[model samples]
Target: MLIALLLAVATVPAGQMFACTPIRVWDGDGPVWCREGPRIRLGGIAAREIDGSCRRGQPCPRASGIAARDALVRLLGGARGRSGTGHILVTGPRLQCRSTGNAKGDRTGAWCSAPRIGDLSCAMIATGTVLRWQRYAAGHCR
Candidate 1:
């Protein structure tokens, strides 16, 4: 349906600027589904996976997956709602992001910023729910 359509057009190339109105979050370093047809993974950071496990070689923060996910939900204008299927419905402001290219699977890794929120990657790190993932930071996680 609509989700399939969004996923199909989700490949935004690296070094491009794009609009994203986040509607759903899937964990901290996300597959944040945007209304304009992109799934973004917040660049420059990493958080625990939903199962509370950190993949080998990834930065492991001292927070649980739920903690990280909730922090991200709050930053994105707070959760409007949530689902049992790990999808968090959010009401965040529209974001402008610069793509760093594909972030595995169907997500684009990007550093996103809104007017009042600033850079999402930095904000997420500030919450201490995630950690700077140097591999993808690319000098942007300040």
Candidate 2:
């Protein structure tokens, strides 16, 4: 019964808590993958706008965003730790994001670290792939 109770009260839905693995990723300030639901976009802090570019030339989009996403994949992959795990934990902000229809629809999500690897956002920022976007909240990335 303990296991049943735990599952019932889980902060995240049981299927997501245990099954929201990163089969794919994208370049959001923080990216969310698809599973059986919409997650990270609903709960994670936006790391950087993939649409924004660092420089403005003829069609010049800042390469930084792509770099950031690549870094995110690398970081997440490195920390994927075990099967069906490594959800990134975005604990700083709990604000609502704009309702944009990304390749996947918008939804709520949970953030966690790759097993024994550490936080994905912090790692990406530290490595210079991402920077703090200060338009959303008043905290770390504020």
> Judged by lDDT against the true structure, how good is candidate 1?
0.89
What's the TM-score of every candidate structure? 0.91, 0.47
Each prediction's total of clashing residue pairs, residues at least 3 apart in sequence or on different chains, is: 0, 11
lDDT, candidate 2, equals 0.42
Best by TM-score: 1
Worst 10 residues of 1 by lDDT: 1-10
lDDT of 2 by residue, 1-142 (tens): 5335323432334233332445445563444543423345422234444555542322222346656666666655533332334333222211212222332334434434455345444455566655544432224322
- lDDT of each residue in 1-142, candidate 1, tens digit only: 6446545665678898888999999999998988888999999899999899999999999999889999999999999988688699997899999888898888998889999889999999999999999888988766
Candidate lDDT (C-alpha), each: 0.89, 0.42
Question: Alpha carbon lDDT of residue 102, candidate 1?
Answer: 90
lDDT of 1 at 23: 94
